[model samples]
Target: MKIVELSMVLKIIPKVLQIFLNFCLVLLSLILSFLLIKELTMFLKIFMTDGSSDYKMFIANILIFFLYFEFITMIVKYFKEEYHFPLRYFIYIGITAMIRLIIVEHDHPIDTLIYSLVILILIIGYFIMNITPLERPNRQK
Candidate 1:
């Protein structure tokens, strides 16, 4: 039998690059989130009066929250070995996003219903994937 030397193991550069990219991307997203929140808060000040449609500001807050939450999830998942996506969180984001899209788009009701159906299918897919059972524990075949 031939022996495999530990020193002969080749380094994987692409994974290293991917790690670096995920880190930088997260930082960029966080910075952008902060800047957007600052700008939106300032912009909403004009609508402080009664009878103003604060819906824009409310939707903005929901979007900003989801953006930052996704950034935080990415940061946490960067070091995890297993698949790192939080399925429920993504589904929740998708639902909120579709709602926001409907609110902002004013599209035909039929189109909006179709879009919502797509989002529902996506959430169901995620749930199915998350609930799938593992075949084995602690041993590789």
Candidate 2:
């Protein structure tokens, strides 16, 4: 009886922890989204006041916004897909981040080359992941 009780408690502990972590993730995502919106608004305000049209800054901010949007999407997908995070979303985020970095800071030839290589690697990984097939459960006849 004690062993059974202990096993049940152990199982319940993990479930409880998972629930708590999920709740925390949701809260953090919400907060991050709000902060992103606030930052976007501030960027707009600065652009309006400065009157200096910097396309690079504009593009960088847009990319940053997409990053935040992607993060929210990942969090939502996590809940929707039974708490499993799809690898493609992470790859997409990585690609977007790399592109943004290159756009914002491509000063050195070597650094740019390295970033390009990393992006290529990530793209290949994404392609490979997409091509891989998931195993289906065997149904007994």
TM-score of each: 0.63, 0.89
Q: How well is each residue in 85-122 modelled by candidate 1, as lDDT tens digits? A: 65566666677677667666655888788878978897
What lDDT score is found at residue 97 in candidate 1? 76
Q: Summarize candidate 2's per-residue lDDT along 44-103 as a digit string, tens digits.
A: 775887667788888888888889889999999999999999889999999999999899
Residue 89, model 1: lDDT of 63
**83: Cα error in model 2, Å:** 0.6
Q: Alpha-carbon error at 114 in model 1, in Å?
A: 1.1
Model 1 residue 27 CA deviation in Å: 2.3
